[model samples]
Target chain A: MMVRMAATRDGYGDALLELGGNQRVVVLEADLGKSTKSLHFRKQFPQRTISCGIGEQNMFLVGAGLAASGYIPFASTFAIFTERGFEQMRNGIARPNLAVHVCGSHGGTHTGTDGSSAQSIEDLAIYRTLPNVTVLHPCDDVSTKILTKQLVHLNSPSYTRTARNKSPVLYDGREDEIEIGKGVIHRDGNDAAIIACGILVSEALQAAQELSLEGIEVTVIDMHTIKPLDEALVLDVAKKCGKIVTAEDHSIIGGLGGAVSEYLIENYPVPMKRIGVADRFGESGESEEMLNLLGLSAPFIAEAVRKLLNS
Target chain B: MSSIAELEEVARKCRVRIVDMVYNAQAGHPGGSLSEIDILVALYGTTLRVDPKNPSWEDRDRFILSKGHASPGMYAILAEHGFIQEHDLTSYRVLGGKCQGHVDAKWCPGVDFSAGSLGMGLSFGMGSALAARLDGSQRQAYVMLGDGEIQEGSVWEAAMAAVHHELGNLNVILDCNGIQNDDFCDEQMRMFDIPKKWEAFGWNVKIIDGHNMSEILEGLEFLKNSNQKPNILIARTVKGKGVSYMENNPSFHGAAPNDEQYALAMKELGVA
Candidate 1:
């Protein structure tokens, strides 16, 4: 199931409206209303949405209180600031097992221009390390909407990362078949697997198209949920394909590549190439230029896959 | 409303619970918890309009412990209010115990939010106050912040947000015993004018003896009648209030009392 074009934040903004319509749902934002697109909820449901001016840590704790008081809360902020509030998320929400949805926008290099400080290049890793936290980075608008709704309903603490820039939608909004821990194989093949998440999914699909002309079939999977990681599917693909390539907009060290490699190294050894920010902070540039400069574009992923297959 | 004698009695029992629970487990923050007991007892026994039987009561006043390591005092109050069985508190910090080192909102019945890391309780209180305004519920949120915990920058961020939002329904009681994790708060981080800082942050500030039941009750009454501004009652207290040896001892910050120490403290409170 695939759509044409959409921004993941758009899906989040849309889903927030739907969630806000429910009397039990409450939305909290930390001054970055426009960045996370939570402004839509603020405009539609002024009463239920609160913008706690530039105080991300306060937003996290406040969300906990609101959730405890019997309201489902979605606390939104930029990835960097949200990372600064990790202690609060760990103690107040996760340790307490409160049903607060901690969502972040401007994830990875897709945030553009603001450079390393603003890009949440390590958001996935930070959240995945925490106990009882579900981390998701949806591929497109459709996937983002599904993940947002799922997180809002999950009894445990959850986090959803949203990209700032627009990207091609890989899944149609009508796919009611979305499961939390299952990865969707966008392209099936025997040569290698290109595991991608968030905005990188669209790039992986594009790379596969280019690679296919050279008589290579690359399997691509949108590993949206990072924790409770689709270990079974990953191992199955690793066993079959023998060569795996992971592409994401986050740090190559702890994002999709690390998660997949950890599973493979422990279970089944395999050759893998990781295409992401190679241990460097993002530079100020347009989103497209940043992807190319950081070697996260479709061409870069395709190139990495070529190298992996040859090795 | 609880009388001065009743509040004192409740405070004495709170200290006993804190000491006994800690002594039993050989793990607890007896110092900070002891300093905070009188105020917590005052809130639960006399000031706060909350039902222990219905912990989630919408209109109930909220009490958040920002200095979460001192959870024994809170657990003791909750037990007294019938939120938990008094005997269940013996399980403090034990394996698979609901009574964790910190208050967990999910596992514990009376806990409004999970807290441990300092400087976060006030933010939760601010949010609750905001929620009450949004939902048209008439409720007040009270928070207890350790003097040492106020060093976190997030505390000021929350203070700014709370006053900016004009949450008159919010009241903060800073347990200004002047002690922190390892040393005196003044030595660790000098916050001499706690009231002035809150006042500058646009809160209605009041400084009072935290152990004095009359002052504690008066502060709560004032917060209840305030129109549209947040309030902070700086309760000056000794680190270990009732016990002679533990009083003003920063070493008791997270130390559990031994059998001998516990016996002496309980004797002082007349709990035995």
Candidate 2:
């Protein structure tokens, strides 16, 4: 079957445009509005969109102020650049539990050619550590649209990381199954499980199909929300599968792999393997080349599953 | 609106509350709080359109204390205005108290935004003003910033944004107390001619004596009528206005007054 591919940033832009109809929804962007796709909302609602002009720190604090004054603000920028405003987000947004949607596009190696400076490998980890913050990494366009729509009603601070490259559509138009902090099990197997998020979710599904060809069945779970993680589902999978392989487009130390490992070690303690960038930065390359080089592709995940089974 | 004499009486009471809270808490910034109490009293009692019963009233003017370490002054003013119970002043900085070390909106009633780290309130005020414009509300936003807080790069970013957006409803009052937590601001970072900087940022600038209730009220009136551009009042003030010993004293910046100093401060303020 041919799969339709779309970038998560496009979905974010489309959702923002739809959210613009609400008078309470205000959008703020750094100078990267065109690149981050927030310009779509800006063009539609010029009066409501604020162009902060290369000032991410001021953008977040302004977003916080808007939120305090009963406006739902979506602050957007490149994922790596959002780090420049982390303190503002922590103090101005999270500390108040203000309803601000912080969207960081071009996350991880999927951003390509921009190199490590532009890509955010540890963005998830940084936001996850903040209190009262909901960290989300959507795998496809469908999930991104659903999550962005839900964020409007969520009266808390949230961080959504989207990708620059097109990823395969993993879900139908079912917003019900895309609840935050709940893992979606794509395929179930008794032998092993592959838990992944972001662009790596599609890779995990592909790896599961390849492993099935060799009579090694594995479950694929889309762990979209990193914070407020679905600990129950992860524990259930650990008990049933007895072996696990985690993959992501971020650094293995603090992304999806780190979150799952930390949970399992304390509760389940099964054989596991983490397939992601290992203590190294990304370089300028095509998205596909970077994913392949960083061992975030299907073949690499399959290799990890094979190695885990043999071990 | 209250008369200048009435406003001065309210400011005197706020100053007494400021010193008492800091002394009881045993850990709070007193010098800057003392310096800023008159301005806070002027706004809460005269300028700002706030209802103690409805703290989150839509269309009400919003105030953000950017120099949040001086939260004792804000808390005292809020209590005086009946936004919070006067007895809560004794619980300042204590556990299970609404008055925290820094101004927290969640814990304290009538606080439009939480602020502790410097250089954030102006941006937040600008945002609130923008939100009001989006909603077609005529609500104004008042931000109190410390002179030392201007050294932060983020404050400049916010200043630029406010001008770019042409936020006429946003008013920033720079409490130029001259002293910071460590020492005098000029001794640390020489900010020569502060009023010119605001003018350079496209703001309608006014310099006034911050401690004088009539000057503060006039500045507020000027900002209310100046709807063509964003307005900033650079109010020159002594670090510790009422207490002679703590005046311009960096040691009292973050320190609660000792017994002898506390008695002397109360006597000087005529609150003894």
Candidate 3:
């Protein structure tokens, strides 16, 4: 696809403006005007954008009401507020199939410097557990933009997890196939398929490049869409490689690892090593420092894959 | 013909179904359901201009149970009015039953909005009222809320919006049974002078004995005639009403009446 380097929040802002170009779309935010990247749309469509001023639960319920009234609503807030509305999202929005898009900024450790609580590692799990909710955590800004637009068109309740800090652009319009529930293989190999999502896709690619030099042919797949996981591709890769490695910037339980493991166990089980944050809280530190401290770098993923392949 | 006497009989029958339905299923929120039975009887039987057979007939009045735990009262009235089979009442809370633990639109007929969670009903009600007005429909929207569930901040936001828009078609009925699941509404959270507070929020307020069918019916009629202001009827009622032992008791808030308790309550309600 024609991917471009834009800030994920900015992509969100642009996609919202594009969404608002349609008269049926309405925008809502909870006081984080600039952070959520909704300020641009708010300024352009003041009548359509309604700010709830940090009241997350009310924003959710009101969005649900508006949705029931036949308006496409994009309700944005920080991950904490988005997580706080788990019940409202489940009952008022998702359960009834209310066409409300829940845009949660700062989804994973990419939020950086903030502690584990703000990282919202459990958000994917929380949203995935709800029936009829489609969960999407894009790899970069461009994917975020495309997915946001696609979700608005889908007319279903969706969660788009975005990052706070900028990272190197991975897809510079070099790809063609980006479909929901379909993994994009950045590299080809028979040794193992290092499936990853969010910012961890970049890490898995770097690891694949390094492992290739050591005579270790590694395949990398970006499993961006978490729910409705690409089970077919995952099982195919698992069968081809005899081993697999999954990584994400989220918790091990209900994040990428859990999704991959649950898929494999049901269809094609293989030796797997999970490269992500363990069951622990995050701490405030520099972005690079936290990444290194948490052992989420390419070296760690490569090491885990190497160990799994050998074992 | 005294409207009060007629409504009293309806309320009595509502309580009978509530006790019987809950006891047969061995599960359901009997306390608040019984407490709100009179309000439902008064609204559906005497006040609200609704054709049960034609529930989604755009011009029919809308009623939402914001405190969804008390949906038994709603189901009893809906079934009695022939919206659904009255024989389906005994399957309350059972798997594959038309009546689940809470109001489910997919499972039951005439259930406008599915609600299992508390505090979301008012905002939905407000939205429906707004949509109706925007579409030039004359039907009014009524939402029944629990006293404790009013503590949810969304309810106030919805209240403020309803007032700001002057949704004359919206009527919020607060089931002031005083008891929540854990404690009495006043003890758990003080909602002193609820009608005055709603008035302060720019709503037309009416305080009445919730159990008194006459007051409920009168309040409903008065609300329908209003032009530019939404109505909030503050109905003070016993938490576990009708049953002698469960009356005013917090324990029955979500408890299903046992066989003996059901028999006694039904006998008192003149069921047998």
Each prediction's TM-score against the native? 0.94, 0.98, 0.89
lDDT of 1 by residue, B1-272 (tens): 77899889888888888888888999788888888888898888867787777887877888888888899999999998999899879878987777888887766888876787888898888878877887788888988898888899999988998877778988888889988887987788898678888888888888888888898888767777666888888889999788889889877888877778888888898975
Where does model 2 exceed 4 Å of error?
Answer: A173-176
User: Worst ten-residue run, lDDT, model 3 chain A?
Assistant: A1-10
Any runs in candidate 3 off by more than 4 Å, and if so which? A1-4, A114-117, A153-156, A171-176, B1-8, B45-61, B126-140, B152-170, B186-190, B199-202, B221-230, B243-245, B256-264, B270-272
lDDT of 1 at B141: 90
Where is model 3 chain B poorest over a 10-residue stretch in terms of lDDT?
B126-135
Please tell me which predicted candidate would have the highest TM-score against the true structure: 2
Which has the higher TM-score value, candidate number 2 or candidate number 3?
2
i-RMSD of all predictions = 1.6, 0.6, 2.5
> CAPRI band of model 1?
medium
lDDT (Cα, tens digit) per residue for candidate 2, span A86-119: 9998998988899889999999998999888998
Candidate 3, clashing residue pairs?
A1-A175, A1-A176, A3-A173
How much is the lDDT of residue A223 in candidate 1?
93
Ranking by TM-score: 2, 1, 3
Q: fnat, candidate 2?
A: 0.93
Model 3 clashing-pair count: 3
TM-score of chain A of each: 0.96, 0.97, 0.95
- Model 3, residue A308: what's the lDDT? 90
Which 10-residue span in candidate 1 chain A carries the lowest summed lDDT?
A169-178
Report how far residue A203 has shifted in candidate 2, in Å: 1.4
Candidate 1: stretches off by over 4 Å: A1-4, B56-59
Question: Per-residue lDDT for B1-272 in model 3, tens only?
Answer: 23778778777877888888888877778889988888888787766777766766666677888888887888888887788887899768888988989998778877777888888888788767765665577878889998999898878878887776678989988888889889887788898878888989988888889887767777777787666889888888898788889988988888887778877887899976
